[model samples]
Target chain A: MQTLHNGKLTRSVSLEDRGWSLGEALFETLLVQQGNPVWLEEHLARLARGCERLQFDFPERALRDDIHQLLSESRDDRAVLRLCLSGDSLGVRGYGAVSRTPHRYCQLAALAPPVRQYWDEGIRAFVAKTRLPEQVELAGIKHSNRLPHVLARAERKARDFPEGLMLSASGLVVEGIASNCFIAVNGELKTPLLDRAGVEGIVRQKVIEVLRTQGVTISEARLTLSDIEAADELFFCNSLIGLWPARQLDCLSFSSFSLCQRVQKELESVWYV
Target chain B: MQTLHNGKLTRSVSLEDRGWSLGEALFETLLVQQGNPVWLEEHLARLARGCERLQFDFPERALRDDIHQLLSESRDDRAVLRLCLSGDSLGVRGYGAVSRTPHRYCQLAALAPPVRQYWDEGIRAFVAKTRLPEQVELAGIKHSNRLPHVLARAERKARDFPEGLMLSASGLVVEGIASNCFIAVNGELKTPLLDRAGVEGIVRQKVIEVLRTQGVTISEARLTLSDIEAADELFFCNSLIGLWPARQLDCLSFSSFSLCQRVQKELESVWYV
Candidate 1:
């Protein structure tokens, strides 16, 4: 695998670099198709917002060059491009004199095996026993403190499922292990509000936008597992997978995916394509 | 700056090492005084517990040998030793087969400047706007998801205070940015319970034990800011500081240091001697 760090392309990184242990990092994963990254601006915008939230200035212009260079050198026509921005704790020597500067790294690798099967045949997902804390300081920003996701993924794997749903402290469904969620309930498309918990994924935002622009009513609100069970259809989305329909979540199952299909078509055809 | 990685003394490490960005890491800080580390066993026990919680094996024996060797080579009579164990996400290929393994790294640094002034003159602290999530899975583990502390420390610095207090989502006082809290209410010692939030600091544990053994009456309870304001005295403790009394938090103020001095003297003479 090829990796780019602070504008320099390298194959490896140092374990001693503060990023690994401190969890002072943020990342964006963009889908690369035909040598181009889909929704590059959205990804960068989120990255910038994350940096601002963490009080670091992002060098988007420099990072854009770094991304293009990495993509240009890659032989794969399509892949997953991961851009990681890590900060240093040097200024933490004492109170009053601290600096929080972040460096950027990019890694290009083979596209993950298509979860197209999940999109077509549907998938099994369940509500995880774990809960997300409603941290306004970290809500929506993709900083690297992802122990919840790591644990949730482990829980999903233990249950013999491909995805798991996370809930907030008050029992509201937040999002999936790695994907954002949407459910069509009572003829209205709904997803969880990320103001208190969950990541604001690029593809999730795009889907909400494109659907709303196409005259579909969408609402971002706090949802529950029962809310999902009441939905006409359900789907999960991220930059890499586009969209995958959930066939089963606990005892609830849906065979009619008309709304999911329509949203998926619009996602791929209008926005991502 | 000498660092020991996996029992081998090295000056630096590579970035490809998995511990940096994944937040798959645990760390312990030991106070080295007169060629002896205070509470070595307790620190290692916490490290072991953190490993178990994260589903990684702790190489306790190897780490013990590494600590001794590093101490033998050190010239400083008093210093701080930071042992960081970072886990790898090597098995996380795409979605299904990510393996997590941890590597250990140790860094020896000069001891932080004593906050005895805070003990002598007392210090100023405030409740941080940022809140800790009530994560049962990661409640007390010292695993390396510390962006909250970084941000809190920054907040404290910006507000021109020596330390900041962190609360849980439900408005319960959890801890300081880097210390455990203790308050004297109705002449009884009270600190926040770590079962649902906050770190289980080694010094905090020792303080509770010593205070109880000395018949000072300490309770671990869910406390609010109002509870703190109602207190007759306030203080903070960690491995590094031992204990420092707070003179003011927001609008509250206190001049008495008799209880804090007694605890501090007992702490240094009994456990840390």
Candidate 2:
């Protein structure tokens, strides 16, 4: 529960006074490893990009310096550092809130390895009755307005499913609740184009880059339930989980040996191995 | 900026410590009139409903009593009161934030009001390029996750229009960014049925109730862009701005004397008269 604003500790401030009520805040959650944040620069860059999108003035150097200082003081090798940028009439600046009890804030109870574990074996997914709004302006940026995802997550949670696929009102497949979706169709990696909606996840971007370097052809295209059902393999990707294979969806199940192994190995090389 | 937790003032609390971050918080915003909040009971009822939706424990009696006590200390007759509910292992309770400088917080700038004034006269609104996700579980409730509206608002703002109309990907018109939409077509008043992907706004509900009492025939139907384009009149409604007429959208414009007079009279009877 340690709080710092502009690299200085503050106490007993009103959340609104601190500008939380104005919805004038942008936040970054970075994974801390070996007492240092992994991909720190990338996270900062994304934070800067988010600030630009919101027209919030970003204090980049100050934030970077503060993180460096805080990491230097911390003893834990792995933790999560949350950087919140609250907008002020003066400008946007960074504040830090760290988990005093790391386990409660950073560690989540591991689920039954997700239904995707059975994807290589066979997993079942269904088109969630949910629809996503097509909003181009906020399409690729991740901001605090996440009620739709929250709703979607609740539905998925209630159904006891690892992930739920969302469709736009137009019946175009968008992405999973918390991950970007991809399908290996006829030996090519295809994901839904995010020009209209969905967050442009950093992990998804990195995975795409890695896949490209490995000579895998990837394309962003409009996908539908039919397209997914016709694919050889289906998977979802996120920073924390890397890759999850989908086996069964609704009543259609696809089991592909080569495609699943290739993606699993590729993600392992980038995340674990 | 004064804050109260369960009617008691406190400083520096964490979502984890208070369990507020667990998504258990329910909030309500009421317009204060001469230091008294307008339709306070209605806002409280909405908050109660939100709590029920989230299955959080709420002490309604205590909260209402506290609000009454706090209102007595108000200096301005007209202000805004925000009530937030949080929970912990202990139980669920409420928090209040009252505006001290009510005038400063209450003034509305004439900054390009959403769409052009001509649209205010009566305009045609097309379905936005983006669609809303239909999640029945979270469809009509107002919770903290508001990213969908944020995206919609940004999209509308980018279009440089007073407002953008959103449709559920299923082709049903839902709502505007921060307002509810209604249409008068073929001698009948129609609005989107909110059983799927829109909020049940207090203002909207109030307007509908008043209209019903006046023996005006209003029906909740799944509407489409074509239906709107063919309508004789269109307007957006919200609590802050009672009813705003749309004059021109995209290329269509309608100036219906009967419709405009009816809406004006409705507002006059509700507020001005």
Candidate 3:
């Protein structure tokens, strides 16, 4: 495994050594094809927004160089790359110390590509009891505070399901445990609005954009389980998986995956940049 | 710096190395005095509950032994010890992998005691714009998803304040940036209910317990900024800082620290266990 830190390659780097708790960091996982990243600018833009929201100074140029170096040195035609930006130490200084200087240590690592079966035949998902809180301040930012997703994934596994559907605190169907969800109802695409909860997934926006460009109106509205049950098709999308049609959600089976397949085809056409 | 991993001494351990993200971890900080940990059982109980909620197999005996080892090898009569339990990776198996064997990489580190001046003289606090989301599943658990606190602390620093009061998503006063909050109103002690938001701090519980034992009434209810502004006294309590009286919250001043002082004195009588 090759790792790049602040534009430099290094094998020995400790994220925990500098009090860089994962929750205090922001990260973006991207799929690379032919030594190039899909939607690199959009991912970095979201990272910068997360840094601003969490008060970390985003070293944009350095991180871009790091990504460039990682891509240039890597030979994997298809793989997963994770760019992690860890911030300053939240020491015992909260006692009386008034301030802290934010530090940036960006690390990028390449990992195995996501499984292909999920995108091929779709996946089974269950509604999780774990809900995303309605913290508007941190909502939509992909900071590393992902306990809700972790618990939701655990809940899905406990129920013997493949993936899980996360709900907002208000019980609205928000997104998948790690992927954004979209459903077709009355021939219109509908996905949950992430203003109150869930990450503003890069692939989700790309899907919406491609659909709109093809003259398909997509509604970014609050979606409920009942809404999903009546939907014509269902699918999950992420930067890594691209798109996985939800073959079954609990007892509700969504076998009509034509729309999902079209979207996935469009996604793959450009996802491997 | 000495590091203890799962009750054994280790000089090197990377939390991210094993795919363990900090948000998937649970931690509790305690003040150690003469080799004894303050609120040992309480902290462990909270950690266990957090483990249960996050699906981590709580290695109770090993953790207890780790605390013992860390405290024994340390020479500081008065110091702070942090017990961190980070769990296994949420592997890229976001596709279909159903289960994961829980890993227990508990790290214990000795940190410097909190600065004393904030405790002696009340610290200044400002209400933070960053609100705690109402995620009932993770409301009171000290899971490491603490980006809200980090951002709130930075907001406080930018505003030139020592501490910040966090409000819930519904505009209710929840707690301090790192501590639980309490206020006096008409000779009664009032604090926010942790069932919906905020951490269930050990020191805050101790304060309530001691005050109730002394026949002082304490109410754990929802509080708002208006309620705080009309209060007689305000204070913050945490396991690390014990308690720090709030001299000023924005423009409202609290000069009478009698109740806060009484609670502080009672807290000190047993906090150095």
TM-scores for chain A over all candidates: 0.92, 0.77, 0.88
The lDDT-based order of candidates, best leading, equals 1, 3, 2
| Residue-wise C-alpha lDDT for candidate 2, range A1-273, written one tens digit per residue | 344556675433235322233333455566565666656677778777777765556677777777776777777644556676643322111121111111111111111222344434544556677576666655776554444454465454423466678887567888887678888877788889987777777766776776788788999999988898789988776655566677766677767745556666765643442
Which is superior by TM-score, 1 or 2?
1
Worst 10 residues of 1 chain A by lDDT: A90-99
Error of 3 at A273 (Å): 11
Ranking by TM-score: 1, 3, 2
Q: Give a tens-digit lDDT track for model 3, residues B178-210.
A: 889999887789999988888899888888888
Native-to-model Cα distance after best TM-score fit, residue B106 in candidate 2, in Å = 17
lDDT of 2 at B240: 49
- Model 3: clashing residue pairs? none
Model 3 residue A88 lDDT? 42
- Give the count of colliding residue pairs in each prediction: 15, 38, 0
- Which candidate achieves the best lDDT against the true structure? 1
lDDT of 1 by residue, B1-273 (tens): 568887877755445455565676788878888678889999999999988877777888888888898889988867888888876655343322254456778877776556556767888888888788888889887877877777776665634577788988888999988889888876678899898888899888877777788788888998998898888888888877778788988788966665677788877643244
Question: What does the lDDT read for residue B37 in candidate 2?
Answer: 64
**Per-candidate RMSD, Å:** 2.5, 8.2, 3.4
Question: Ten residues in a row with the worst lDDT in model 2 chain B?
Answer: B100-109
